[model samples]
Target: MTGPTLLADLVDTSQRVGEHAGRRTKIARLADFLRRLSPEEIDIGVSYLAGVTRQGRSGIGYALIRDAQPAANVEVSELTLAEVDATLDQIAGASGRGSIADRTRLLSALFARATTREQEFLARLLLGELRQGALEGLMIEAVAAAADLPAANVRRAAMIAGGIASVASLALAEGAAGLSRFAIALFQPLAPMLAQPADDITDAMARIPMAALEWKLDGARVQVHKSGDDVRVYTRTGNDVTAAAPEIVSAVLRAQAQSLILDGEAIALKPNGAPYAFQDTMRRFGRMLDIEVMRATMPLSVFFFDCLHRDESDLVSTPAATRFEAMTAALPSELLIPRLVTSETSAAQAFYDDALGRGHEGVMVKALDAPYEPGARSATWLKVKRIHTLDLVVLAAEW
Candidate 1:
């Protein structure tokens, strides 16, 4: 029905299904109800499905659905079950090969079959998120209940349901009994991220198992959070900082992956677009309010060395090498870390010399297999730089 009503149904269904978790007979009954819906009806069903599924009683199975915007001609704000089901079928048929005409026809068919509530449900399903139950299994039950069937059967049936449209059709065909044999699964764990604290970078170093050190960059720390077509940038303080770095944000938005969060430093670049010194980038830091002045004075060039999340997977607990591989694969060539692998102290020293020759702060020597730990500062990293410091009797003290 409508987004709200369908959401309510999903919750009720999931609760019903939940009531008989291990009962295979009940689950089978739910499955049958899911089988009865048409492709268009399935489209309507998934909006509520997605909402309830997201709400903890279920998982993240709805990720397979490609979220779309509302129709240009429609004035309504939400979607219905049949509309959601039809949309899913259209998307499934379009997978890998479907022309614009095919998509248009699919939409037309959905619009024709979907009731007002179904239309609303379909709209939300296309968007891929429903604020309602939002749990996976629970939503499936809600769909079952909407069709006058047992919620218990649908819970297990979700596993073999394939996609929303598939589940809807099955529910319609055999009622509750049809839904008991699907393969729906729960959401994956949160993607791992390299931990860092707002209070101190050095503290983060202490948590690492191997050699870790401070990276003194006169630049800003950036956390790029991306989900589907949307990408947003945040500073170390978790403030939204995308407007100031549109170029970088656009670059990240164009990436081929599905979802991710990355960590790196963004420094200002020269007119020719070459990276400038760290000090030059410092001029633009913390100037979010005066974006125009900052943009004109110093633009940024981002360098990515670590990845926190990649395509629905967290990499925090993963070893550095593993995370590094993913980082290299996804990172653009122009913005990259100058990496060096060395097991020997002498080799590390040599690398340090080269880094200094290139005007870098120093070379960071890290243990080959260490997990990133945030908020601890210690020597899992060794930073070597060439500079002389001495107190030459106040040579000239001028304020």
Candidate 2:
């Protein structure tokens, strides 16, 4: 029988993946490494290569990591991937009283067994600084290449599976046939389809002359899942916020469908129906404590724009118009967002103006016949704003 895979092997593969410039070269190296991993190691190995830990954040920050580092690294590599993963599992499960010291002890013990290079990799992985360019997109390509399946097939499976690691595990194990098992289920949140920013309404209309335009409110994006009376809400990043948004849950429970997954925005509205600031909506959406007080003081309203699943049918690959029709049939008109489908640029411009006049951020121009591409900034969907906005990352900030 083959012995357990070494952490050094994964670290070496990650180094090679980072050193390569071409995407094909990166995918080739990643695919080779993925093929060599045993069945039990695929999920953990894939997540690490994709720049995340399987255990998620382990409460080990920079200070704690620094304090936990050994005075000297091990002379030789001895740690296996399973061993490292087990250590992280323990660290993540450590909580409540004496958790910090327990975490520090676990970190120290793990680091003490790792060599110099392995120590660097572990520190970076723990601190979320693992920027080797092996992001989810490239990893998806690698998984496809490794599994000998089309990239689109793997991507679609990843969309429904919520992450590439789990999809990779299945694809590598059972190939295309295993992927067929993935389907939209209640409470399992899929990544929200993203939109590319258009220069203006005219630009958007030019690209998609016949489009479905909906007001883009300055609010929190929420995906609600319901089965019978059980309802759950997830944020854009798939964090469960059901407990924080009881009003949203109650509203979803009242919907006509027995099982449904609806994507929309949640905004805190004034008594007269004007939306509060984005931060205010987020404050209510992100809160876990004093929810009743917050809900009473600043109530949130939801407006559905797309339906992904209804009862036993999966509508992810359904045309936008059909999905909208399904949403309309299942939800009250007040629960759906205001939308207008038209080919005329003049009508589209008027709708855009009205959305801005109502204090929304802008409008989304989506192709009526196009299917939703989850987690993708698809050209089929474009966002038009009155003023162009640029997002910047601060390298250095001085007061």
Candidate 3:
């Protein structure tokens, strides 16, 4: 009903857990509420939801509208405290879009009639940290509670609404429970695993755990799924990217294996078959490029290490050696994953030494008996980087 309450509701509806239809219904409701509020009250609401600039500017209303338009090309960046204060001042004094008796009036009119991108920009300007925070969630809950609707129902309904504003509208009418009822889909078996910082070969080698080690190549982490002639390639984020790298996808399609998921590094290779820098491979990712130029500039070679799906069964729970065997059988190239046949730590160390001599990053020490955990960066498959450093602790205390 109020500006702050409306803003909060919009945020709640944007939560990924809700149903799309419900969220849309909520958005429509919020829009109706905005229509009832006076321009001045709306400005006050914007300022309250997102702190007003020192100059009294509340860009939240304008931002919200701008964000909804396809033609609205807006770039948001981090702002300093001083910048926030200045914008507030400028907004408070400026009058153009509508009759402005005050900052609140101006903001209300801006949001009420502005484009989607404008509204999005304004909301970000108001909320500060527009990417992630409690504002979106809290607003939804506040709105739902205000309307005396079961928050859970609203949240479920919100999934249909989609977008930040739609969810917010639901929250205004239904409350926090509405946002909570929706199921959030992560969609992938793997999350984005962070690479431990490895400056050089020695540093990577030292980090290697006491387990079976394979050379770590400089490449992009790729998950390849093959079911007969069909193939799927997923990046670390689980986004399907088979079309981006058709050659690699086709290679997986041609594999003799049926229904297998192989996790490995996809590297750009030189003409003589040497892998290029990691940056080179990154250039080809998610780009519309000429195939001939792409092949010439960034030829890729996927080095398989772990197998998840194998032979009509998910072999992720199987032992590392078993999975390795399956991976080896699925492809003919030794370059897939050059493994060593030695239980001895010294032998593994020797292999690591040899791999580095071939310009590899380092070795990944995997427990031979372990299962393939997609996203886990456990010590079971410890990554060893070759870097030299001492963990030196400060002897004295600092303020």
Candidate 4:
């Protein structure tokens, strides 16, 4: 049987990945490292290379990490991947009275066992300062290479599966068939589909003629999931903001569909129906305290643009026009964004101007037949904004 993988080995690979400037080289190193890990270690190993601990954040700040550091690192490395993960689990679970003391003791013990290089790696990993060139995209490529599967397959699975670490574990064990099990389910927030920027309305229309144009509000991008009476809201980055935005949850609960996933923006609107500034909207959206007071003071309004899932059907692979139709059938027209489908540039430009006049950022021009490409800045969806140039003098420099 293969022995446990060493933490030092992962640290060494991360160092090498950081040193390499070429993406292909970094991916190769990561893939090779991933292939060496046993099935159980795959998730933990992948999370590390992707610059996160398996236990997520443990409330250990930089000051705590600095104070917990051992005066000297061990001359020889004896830490295994399993050991490190176990220790981190303990740190994360350290709560209640005297939890700070417990966390400090655990961190100090772990640091003491680590070698010089291992200590450096651990410090950076805990503080989220691990700046290896291996980002999520590179790590996804590496997982695909290691598992001998198509990168697109891994990426899609990762999008639905929430994170690459779990998908990596599954892909390495069961390959393509295992990945096929992932689907858009209620309450599991899929990453929002991103758009590429277009120069102007004419350029956007030229790129995607007969496009669907919708107002791009300068507010928080939210994906709302609903199943019967249960409704949840997630930010663009896939954070569950359900508790933070009770108004959004209530709105989703009232939607016509029993099971639905709607993508759109949540903005604080003035009494006259114009949107507040982006920062003002965020202040209301991001707040978790005194929510009822904020909701009363600055009411949030949602405008749905696309429906990814409706009733029992998953429409991620469905065309844009079809998804919008589903959204229309499931949501009240007032809840839906103002949209116009047109091939005429002048007509599209008029819609764009109308959106700007209503205090939105600009407009998004999307191909009617384009399928939703989650987590990608797809060219099929183009954002057209009025650019303003300003002159400024640099009075201060820091570095």
Candidate 5:
């Protein structure tokens, strides 16, 4: 489409994008560049501008990339976009006994052919840290501009698609129609909805009138997705921990729902029925082999707060209260977290006090009518917690 676009062009563009302080200028430059790239190259361009590699910091580390260097007078325009992509794929896929040596040889050859600028960019790409000021937000706007669609549509597609690469390619090629096809598939972890910080219940209540207050447990956040007998658990960062959380997996299998996605927290409890310390729960989380032994000693209990999907429906678009209702209807009472819907100041304070007294960190006050907004955080959901600032110096450690 544009003179068989070279990797140098991309490296040069990244440098230009990073130089500008104004966001509008960065968006304009990126959109212009995206328009020139072929359809196959759009995803790569998006990944570069968004400050990452498609390989995602695969096996290769910064030390490995730093040792590999190029000559002073190197070829600038020899490598094409597809050529660089293939080289990265090979480096990422290198495995087995002599794999590290093989990877080093591959990097040496690739860098030797690249110019100084290309080498610099490639090293950063492999290390997965493009210092370019342009990131996903800027890339989304650029993709929207290149595709001639509203930025909102592209952003929504990004949330469902789980990243900007596929969304960019789809938006640039097929526009809005391609984006519409991106939906929440079973067991595919969508980005978890996040919350904003609030000082206290009164301040939080002032932001949202009919707030849903739930005890914020001091434990790991979990997203449990169940499709019939199939169940999986994902951590806050969307890593599958189902095998590590056998109790949670079993509860989801036993839950009343057939098709559902649940958002919850798993807390380890003492024999006296009080919850154990957060650190103790994390120990159990890290214990892979001694799970059954730990279950007898320090059993973990899950408390689900939000239902993202249930019974062949995406419940995220519904009101928070509606989703909570579905969650109550499906899960056992022991599995559901303690929650209350109240606008009164006194009730909110009592809930807050009760949670802290019961070994929890604090309570989360959420808007009853608010839809689940993933990735972005706002005042719609407020977490009120007691703050204890610490300034410490590590003196010594036993090895």
Candidate 6:
């Protein structure tokens, strides 16, 4: 496959990207490398450029990498991308009993074969410290350039597709038309839409004249996908948390619609029907081992605020008002986040105060007609918090 490109090639490209002062040079270098990747190499190549492992994580710490003794006889271009990827996959997948030692041995073997430069690159790649200036944004630009597609189209497709690697492969192979096929699907997650922070309720309400004020709880953001008997819950970063939150699964199954994607938050509750502290909720959120046992004590609740898909139709393009309406129709009151629709500044302020009084973080003011813009933080959604933050200057630091 295309002369079996070496790990040295990518490392060399990354070095050049960082060394170049001009942005165009960095973009061009990355684009040239991206053009050489085959279909199977897209995910691995993209992950490397983004300073992460395609295998999620290597479970290799700095100490482990530090302990890996370097080799005497250097072979710079001997390690192929696929070969390195296979070794990393083994290390990441290692588990049970002596898995750590097994991983250590495997890592040692790889390090022993790697040249000094390749070993240094491997350490950075494993530690996610690839300080090579070209982050995912630049990677996206390079992908766009290599595929001969508009950057915006590539970005939008990447957002919907959930990963740039797949989008890149498609774009390179099928061009712009391939990227257009990405749509809202069950079990897959697009990056969650984020909001801007508002100084006060008045300013927040001013931004969206007729707005919807939803009680913003200090809880884990969830995107629920339900299709017939199948149900999945994902965190904001797209980690599946379905097994940890069973009540959420039941709630989705009871939803009126057969297939839909509902976005909301999951908060733990106390016996008194009040939400627990944010930290307390997190403990419950992260507990997968004794979830059933802990569910009885620190039971969690789901609150649906936005509907991304419904009745086999993608509603992300629809206005907030329409999506909220769909969410209302689908979710029972017990699972719905408390929301107030108003144009009055007084009402917005009152809602914000009431939310804080009820032990919530803040209130989210959303423009009624604003469409959900995934992977973006815009003024369409504003958070009005009770406590204000001060940006302090750091004049000195001590180690």
TM-score of each: 0.42, 0.86, 0.50, 0.81, 0.85, 0.84
Q: Model 1 shows how many backbone clashes?
A: 111
* Local distance difference test scores for all models: 0.52, 0.91, 0.55, 0.89, 0.84, 0.85
RMSD each, Å: 17.1, 3.4, 13.5, 4.0, 3.7, 4.1
Best by lDDT: 2
The best candidate in terms of TM-score: 2
At residue 129, candidate 6 shows an lDDT of: 79
Residue pairs with backbone atoms closer than 3 Å in model 4 (clashes): none
Ranking by TM-score: 2, 5, 6, 4, 3, 1
Residue 16's lDDT in candidate 4 = 94
Look at candidate 6 and tell me the lDDT of residue 258.
89
Clashing residue pairs found in predicted model 2: none
lDDT (tens digit, per residue) of candidate 2 on 1-399: 168889999999999889989999999999999999999999989999888999988788877887798878899999999999999999999989999999999999999999989999988988789988798999999999999999999999898777799798889999989898776778888889999999988899999989999999999999999999989999998889899999989888888889999999999999988889899998888889999999999998999999999988899899999999999999878899999999989999999999998888899999999988777789999998888579999897432
Model 3: worst 10 consecutive residues (lDDT sum): 45-54
Looking at model 5, the pairs that clash are: none
**Model 1 agreement with the true structure over 166-201: per-residue lDDT tens digits:** 465566666656665442111211122233232222
Please list the residue runs of candidate 6 whose C-alpha ends up more than 4 Å from where it truly belongs after superposition: 71-75, 196-211, 237-244, 279-298, 341-347, 377-399
Error of 1 at 163 (Å): 41
What is the lDDT, from 0 to 100, of the residue 34 in candidate 6? 84
Cα lDDT tens digits for candidate 5, 1-399: 556678888988899999999988988889999999998888888887788878777677866765555444375568878887788899889999988887887887788878877887888777767789888888888888889999888887787676778688878888888888777788788888888999888898888878889999889889988988889988987888887888998887878888999988998988766788889899887678878888888777899999989988898789998999998999889888898889898999999999888878999999988888666666688999978899999997532
Q: How many angstroms is residue 172 displaced in model 5 relative to the true structure, after the best TM-score fit? A: 2.4
lDDT: worst 10-residue window of model 2: 390-399
Count clashing residue pairs per candidate.
111, 0, 82, 0, 0, 0
lDDT assessment of candidate 6? 0.85
The 10-residue segment of model 1 with minimum total lDDT is 184-193
| Cα lDDT of model 4 by residue, 1-399, tens digit | 269999989998999999989989999999999989999899889998888988887988877887787877889989999999999999999989999989999999999999978988888888788899877889999999999999999998887776798699889888998788777778778888899999999889888988999999889999999888988899987899998889888777777888999999999999998888889999999999999999999988998999999998999899999999999888878899999999999999899999988878899999999988777779999998879899999997532
